[model samples]
Each structure stands twice: as C-alpha cells, then as structure tokens.
Target: MLPELKDISNEEVKLPESSKVRLFIKREDRIHPFVSGNKYRKLKYNLIEAASLGFDTVLTFGGAYSNHIAAIASAGKLHHFKTIGVIRGDELRSKKDYNPTLKFAQAQGMKLHFISREVYKNKTAQTFLEELKRTFGSFYTVPEGGTNALAVKGCEEILKPEDSMFDYICCSVGTGGTLSGIINASKPHQHIFGFPALKGDFLSDIISKFAMKRNWELQTAYHFGGYAKINNELIEFMNRFKAENDIPLDPVYTGKMMFGIIDLIKKGYFPPQSNILAVHTGGLQGIEGMNLKLKKKNLPLII
Candidate 1:
C-alpha cells in the first residue's frame, strides 16, 4: 500500500525591505520521499481507478528524467501492480544504468521501453496507443506528465481553506494540471500565477481546458530556455535559496517559479502587503540526474 500522506506545512519566504509582499511556500515536497507533491496528487485517483477496473499493469510515457515515470514506478511496486514506462530517446535503452531515474524505476521492477523522439511525440495518438496495447496487452495509461481529469481533481486539494486569505497563489506549470486544480479551488479574489517551465503561450490554452476559473495568468519569462534547461544564474539562485531557507528547489519546476516570484517582487509587480503563497511541487528526486548533466557541461550543480 502507498504510504499515507501527511499534512504539508508552508514555509515563509523572507522578502526584501523594498518589497512589502508577504510570501509563503506550501511544502508539498514533504508528502513522500519519492511520490511527493503533484506527482502524489496526480497519481492518487489514477491508481485507485486503475485498480477498481482490475488492471494488473499501468503504462505511461515520459522522458529520461521524468518525475511522473519515477513516481508511477514506485507506486506500482508498492501497490503490487506491474508498470511499463515508454521512455523517450531510443539511445537511453542501452544506457539505463547511467540514468539515475530510469535505474531506480527499473530496480523497482518497471519494464522500460525506449522509443525515438518522433514516436514519443505521437504518444497520445490513437494509432500509437493501439500499437502499445497490441504490444503490451491491456493496461491503465497515464499521460506523459501525469496530467488528466483525475490529476486535476487530486491537485484541487493542494489548497486549504486557510490558504484563501492569500491574494496570490503561485506555482510552476508543467502540463498545467496542478494550476488547473488550483484555479478551480481558489477564491474569486485570489489571482493565480503560473510560471511555465517551457516556452510559448500554448500552455495557457492547455490550462484553460481544465481550469474552471479565469483568475489565473502565466508568467512565461522565467523558463530560462525551456523544459529541463538551466543556467548558472538559476543554479546559483537555487543554491542560495536553499542555503537561506533550508528548502531545496528542483531546477525543472519549483526553482524557476520561485526565482520568477522573487524577481517580480523586486520589480514592484505586486502591491504592498500582498500575500502570496507559492506551491512547492516536488521534483527533488530528479536532481541527481540533473547534476550529472551539469557535470558534463562543467556547470554549477544544484545544491
């Protein structure tokens, strides 16, 4: 059985004297060591529904260092369900031992199927799914980022009644599931700010599909290149933030979001005395793999 989730607490972020905004971070990372934050929420009902329908296996898609892939693999092992991970990049198939995320998933008994980038792009296509079913037999399928209706439902619980007091709710956007849930659950007066980990305005459209409210906006400038892409500045900011707050931020999501929030605050974006709560969606498990890439580039690693 999956471990019971604990009540996650929020950590206050001390701001500069020039900015009168009060910032706090909801530490969802503490939910579980492996399947934490949005990963835990997104998979909670998916796993339940999969079992209710008597599915013995769970199949999903992800890249080399996907938190969703790792979370599902861990969850499957704990719940006694077989797991299949259709990983992007065919070259990674032979180098599984080098990729920490894939290695851990495999060690947990998840069967890894590495496919080319082109084929991985069509993962949601009907033909692709049909082919997967023919190859692996029937199984419950979770999307690449684990964002679906059930996932959005699970994320809605991230905010509690006390959180309604905040004027702004901030979070990093991946597939937009977590933000959608937050938008649905947020009070009318609260404005939700989403920092996309990738470039482009397409995320706004994707988020609108699930979000029921119109009180949210996307801050697309802090992506720092694109998904899984990082720089020295971001690395420095992450390390400094951790050193000061004792809260580790993953480069893929939370780190970028927090960085953006601080920059915006410095620029006088928020009115004085505004209360902002940032959602710390956990992706810490992917840090080891990220550090490997940084080492290859001789760049500073996330602390």
Candidate 2:
C-alpha cells in the first residue's frame, strides 16, 4: 500500500539464436520478499476493503507450503491485522517446526488452525464456514489462494498500457486469480496463457468466474506431476536457469510456468518475432521447505 510501484522492472530473457520470439520476465518476485508478485496484487484491495469494513482479523486457507499463507501472514503483520491460517493436513500441526512456511507464518503472529484434507475440501461450504465463524469470531475471509472479486480487481492491474505491445501475456496459474486478471486486462490482439501448477479441469471454471475476456488459454502439460510435486528434471532445470539468468525460480509455480513457456517456444508455439511477457509470481518462500523434502529424496536442490 505504501508506494511499492517503483520496485517492479521487466527484464528481457535471453533465448537461443534459433528462437523466433522475444521473451521478457516481469520481476514481480522482487517487489517484496514476503508479499511479492501476484500475492501482493491479490491482497491489495482485499486488505483495504477489510480495513474499510472495520475487520481487525483476516482468515484464509492453504496447504503447509502455500505462498498465499506466507504472504497473508506477512501482509497482516505489515498492516497490523490479526491473521489466521487454516492449514490443510491436520498432521502438520505437530510438524510445524520443521515446515519453514508454517513457521514463518507463526513468527508473524498467524494463528494456525490445522484441518484434515477432507474437511479442507469443503472449505467454501456454508456449514463449514459458519462453524469457522463461530470459532474465529468475525474475521475477514480471504478464500483459499486469495481468489475473489476484489482480488481479481487487483490482478487486473498487472498489465498496463505499455505492456499492450507484447503479443502474449504469460503467468503461473494457481487458483486462476492472476490469470483471470491478465485475461481481463489484455489488449484485444494479445493472447494470455496460463501454465497451471496443478493437474485438474476445474481451474477453467474458476478462471471464467473472474475473467472478462476470451483471449486466454491454459498450457496444461508442464505441472511436473501436480501441485507441490517436483522431480530431478525440474530441479536441474531450475538450477541451470538461475545460473544462466541470475533469476531464482521457486519449483512449484514460477519454475513450472517458465519451463512450460520455454518448452512451448522450443516446440515452435509462438509466431515469429512475437513479443512475450511472463509474470514472475513469487513463491520463493516455499523453496526452503521444498529443499528439505528434496534433501530427503536426494534430489538436486533448486538454486
């Protein structure tokens, strides 16, 4: 809320000589260490609305390593709002110390309520929400991954008039809030592409709920097995990418989206001389926990 607009910069990415299109990545990851990228955009209006409505507390849902949870905790701390994270997998309650994401949230004064995966599936249901209301008592609800009307409104600002020159707008898809915003803000001639981090058909439905344009498509082939699921190939790619680009990518979201975009380019997906702009949605906080898992599996860690 305090003039962070000056920090964002678009860096052109190097491509092979044979490549047909020009590629650039918007360094939204550097916007803020905690509340970075689309998470910051999604929360901007929602937090303001919460304060405007006189809500002192904000509650949201997420997994153990969710970037959304970390951003919310950090945002709450920055804005002086009480935060509650309804974390999935009740088993993680005892393992909180080992999970850096949850630990960071706790350190930021987030009250975490662990729930079973089954119960988390019904998070938006009326009865479950009412039960949570009775428990937490009068808190602003930021839906899982923070996708809501106000959040989408914030996302629409990701693209600007100057960005209209680009032929394509690309970003990682989580709950589809950011993608929907890009789609809504894109120029008529530009196409928006979303690279989903999870495997599912439900995302399109969610994106349609907020998107106001039809110039978008989801590239579904590069999720790397599913949400939070990564292997050696992706780890190696991420490491090599950082070594070359000097830009660190989190394995879950940004890494997969980058991988997909590059792969598509190599496969001759884009038109010749087309300009492509990729949004670097930050999820770097999840890397610590992911590296811990990678250590256990003996997979190469993301650099």
Candidate 3:
C-alpha cells in the first residue's frame, strides 16, 4: 500500500494581547483532495491489513452523515476494494429524496444498508457482526469511526518529532477511537485531551480503559447541543474563525474543538508561551449537507 503524506506549512497565529499565546495549526485538514486529515491516518493501517489478509471487500457502520463512511467509501474506491456502508438511519419513503451524504456514498459505489438506531447500536454485538459476516461472506469489518488497534497505529505516525511540540493536544471525540490512538502513541511529556461530541458520561471510563490512561484529563464543556446540533454561537465562531484564518471548519468536528480550545485558552488553561495543537479531523463533506439544513432555518454562514 502506498501511503501519501501531505506536507503543510505551520501557520503561526497570533492571539490577543491579554492572552499572549502562539498557535500553530498542523494542517491535517490538507491531507488529501477529498479524504483528508486524521481519516487517512486512521484508515491506512486497517486498509493495508485488510488487503494483506486477503479480504476483497470491506463493511462498516456509520450514521447517515458520517465522515467515517465518507472516508471509507473514498478509500475503498481509491484503493480498489469493494465497500458496503451499513448506515444508521431509515430510508426516506420518497425514493428520490435522498440525503446528500447517502447520495455521495452511493455514487462512490458503496452498497447502503439502512438500519434503525436501536439495531445500529448492536453493530459490534457478536451476534450482529456474525450475521453480517454470514450474509456478506468473509469481509473486513471496521467499527464506526474506524476504531481499532490498527487505527491507533496509524494515528501514532502523526506524532513525529518534526511536528511542533505541543503542551496539550485536543481533538473531537466520536467513538473515543482517535483520542485512544493518539494517547497510545503520544510521548509521556505531551498531554492528550478529548471533547466528547456525544452526550454521555461513560466516555471517560471508555477512554481510560482504551488508552490505559487512568489519570488522563477529560473535559465535557463543548458538546454545543449534543451530536450534530449547533447553536448560533458555534455557527458564529466557525464563520468568524474561518474569515480570520481562511481555514475550513465544519461544526461537527474541528469547529467544536476550536471553540473549546479558544475558550480554554481564554480561561487561562495554558500558561504563557505554552503551545496547543488541535487535530482537525476531516468531515468537510457533511458541511455541504449541513449548510442545506441551516440555510432553510436562516442561520448565517461564512463559506
């Protein structure tokens, strides 16, 4: 498998006089023309392993507008693997009225299987995965958001010495996969932080068990109205931040992390001269679909 690494320049962003912080973005956002950022790192090892194990097809679970699904589909097509997306949502009665994300997945040749939210929760249940295996024949199964040991290995590659040394690294947590991977790969000197996008209290325990970081720090201040729900302030921040830096920030991932990071910096979370690295997990495709929803509600946008 040929791994493509994108070289991006670090931008030295200035903070307020009162804050006095120097911020540098690693630009994982520019990992690829389509499937970019942490998604590539998360999927690389898994894809290679699947191919090596002689798996001709790949099957995974995700929501109707999951970046994971988009990335998987994109990777499958690019890497010449058959793909199936067991999407979590009901099919619209109107056959022509398809969600944009589902449309994109289908366009990429991803066989779509709709499932109820209740049943979707059982994706990892032994019986369910076995049933899928029987139905689809032998195939590789990646958890939603590409969580696994292989995914963690891919994330570790992102922590090279050439990358800026950060006091703290922050990322949006979905299934606790990316954070868990980063934690496993990070040096003891660097700290890893997660902002849970879902409204659940048990994620800390999940992360603790996954990363073996019994004393790791977990913060829940920035769910911003739960999964996929965004308020005006978040929208405003995404727009303003993009305008100031010209960086694309989808509210679902990077936007929320940026909001939380800024709030943390303003609250004096970091001391003087301390650097922070915020991982930009890519979900830009969902932004187009989100805009369609927000536009109908007259919510303002930047891009």
Clashing pairs in 2: none
* Candidate 1 lDDT, 1-303, residue by residue in tens: 456666789889977766788999999999888888999999998999999999999999999999999999999998999999999999998999999999999998999999999888999999999999999999999998999999999999999999988999999999999999999999989999999999999998899999999999999999999999999999999999999899999999999999999999999899998999999999999999999999999999888
The number of clashing residue pairs in each candidate reads: 0, 0, 0
Model 3 agreement with the true structure over 1-303: per-residue lDDT tens digits: 536785655665456778766676667778875577778888999989999999989999888778888888888888888999997765531341357777777788788887777888888899998888888888899888887778777876666665537777777888777788778767677787888888878877766666855424667889987898897899898888887887878878788888988998898888887877777877788888788778889987547
The lDDT for every candidate, in the order shown, is: 0.94, 0.92, 0.78
Which consecutive 10 residues in model 3 have the weakest lDDT in total?
Answer: 89-98
Cα-based lDDT at residue 262, candidate 3: 90
Question: Which residue pairs in candidate 1 collide?
Answer: none
- How does model 3 fare in lDDT? 0.78
Task: For residues 180-282, write the lDDT of model 2, one tens digit per residue.
Answer: 9889888899999999999987899999988888999899999988999999888888898888899999999999999999999999999999999999999
Better of 1 and 3 by lDDT: 1
- Candidate 3 stretches greater than 4 Å from native: 92-97, 212-215
